[model samples]
Target: MPQPAPAVQRSGGPIAPHLRRLLEFVEPGREDVCLDVARGRGPMPAALAPQVRHVTAVDAMPEPPARADTSGRMSTIEFGTGPVRITGDGGPDGDRPAAATTREDRVRHPIGPDRPTIKADATALPYRDNAFSLVTARFSLYTLGDPDDVLRELLRVCRPDGRVIIADLVRGNLAGPERDRIERLRDPDHPGTPSIARLTEMITSAGGSIRRLDVFTVERPIEPWLAGACDDAAADRIREALLDEVDGGPKTGAKPRVIGGELWFTQTWAHVAAEPIP
Candidate 1:
């Protein structure tokens, strides 16, 4: 049995550059109510909180053990229309003082307060129809067994004129199956990574009209990528496979290559934005 994927170590840190890129497709609005599915310990809620009216983050995974706060003092800020308060140590921006007068004030101080996060299943979301203007899931599809059901639920909760955004790592047409095999070796719970075409089909089949589709390649070092794997033996196997591929062995579909004496590989990420066809 494969061990669970390791918890994200950069939780609560500044928003990642890759996540920032994904947000471009989301285009959150000030009046929009957003729902982020399978939101792990990501900074999506905090990143979207200031830009949107409200953001509800849901995940099936139980909350991880809290890390000790090095900064002793705690502060609070008002979030959204409701009294959802964000509390954290060391001011809003880690060093700056908290401001509460206007939206501009909130935008300038993006790093304060923990937003609301609910533990829930994605296929069976606990929300009413047409509840949110923007529904999003990032890097979640490969973990789910029934992505089609999850997509339908996303569309079910989105307003008619609203957008449903999905982003995940994809496999190349020829290399996809082999890539998925390696991914499973690293994390047994991983269901396979879908090709871009397959993902688009799933969305369209689930009552979504594609508005925009973007595909980009991200290069990652093998060590950092394997750092999230909980199984040491599995991680070693993946490393060996990539190294073997580099030495002209069977292709692992990871497109592994050595860069300045370190092993590296590439991943294709696809971002799709769709609207519910009402």
Candidate 2:
């Protein structure tokens, strides 16, 4: 399990400022059925649950199966209507109750009667066409090898008139590619971060009509940011690079600097909403 970072260091803190703006832009309604793809450990599900009719949170990895206690009652998470259902192929037979072993999963994506958490690939969703009113992917695209395919899938599962909300870290400046390099150092799974223009272009290329687009920057502390590293060596390398940048060795696009005696950097985030073009 990853150690918890301070709220401020983690995506502008809980209920992040950008997220609040996203919710405002979405204007979720009581009758809306939402699909949150590649939710990971973000707070989107919990934030949307209270406002929407139902929320289905999906991730590529499956949680351990949840078991019924001796009394016959199953342990349940608070957000959803029932126990979490884990599926390998997003098929009926693959569906089964799963228990979340990690503390992060338990708190961020609990299975309940209303919300059903599923394990399935984002490139190929398991839902029928135009199944949801709101389809969202938050901070998930940078990790995918085929983000374009995932974007198409998001549009496929979304209602024609519904919104597809995609929020991700965008390259801020000329050094943005360097920032991506550093991020990949921390987590090799990250393919690359995109510029705001590229992100919007992707939506259009995926047959989506852009409804709204918002971009903002957040300052993050170095230690907490490195907490998600693949291992100690990766974290150390990232740290050394940042420290070097701070010492004026070379510009890393990370914009590393000293803030109150702590190393900090900035990340530009882009939040976009689009509708499937018929």
What's the TM-score of each model vs. the native? Answer: 0.74, 0.72
Clashing pairs in 1: 86-113, 87-113
Q: Write the per-residue lDDT of candidate 2 for residues 73-142, one digit (tens) a residue.
A: 1222111111112111211111222442232332223335544466667787778899989998877764
Cα lDDT, model 2, residue 191: 65
- Every model: Cα RMSD to truth: 13.9, 13.2
Enumerate clash totals for all models, in the order shown: 2, 14
Candidate 2 ranges beyond 4 A from true positions: 1-14, 39-41, 62-116, 173-176
- Write down the lDDT of every candidate, Cα atoms only: 0.67, 0.67
Candidate 1 lDDT over residue span 98-192, tens digit each: 22122111111123344335656677777888988999887765443378888999999999989888877776555537888887887786767
Q: Pick the candidate with the highest TM-score.
A: 1
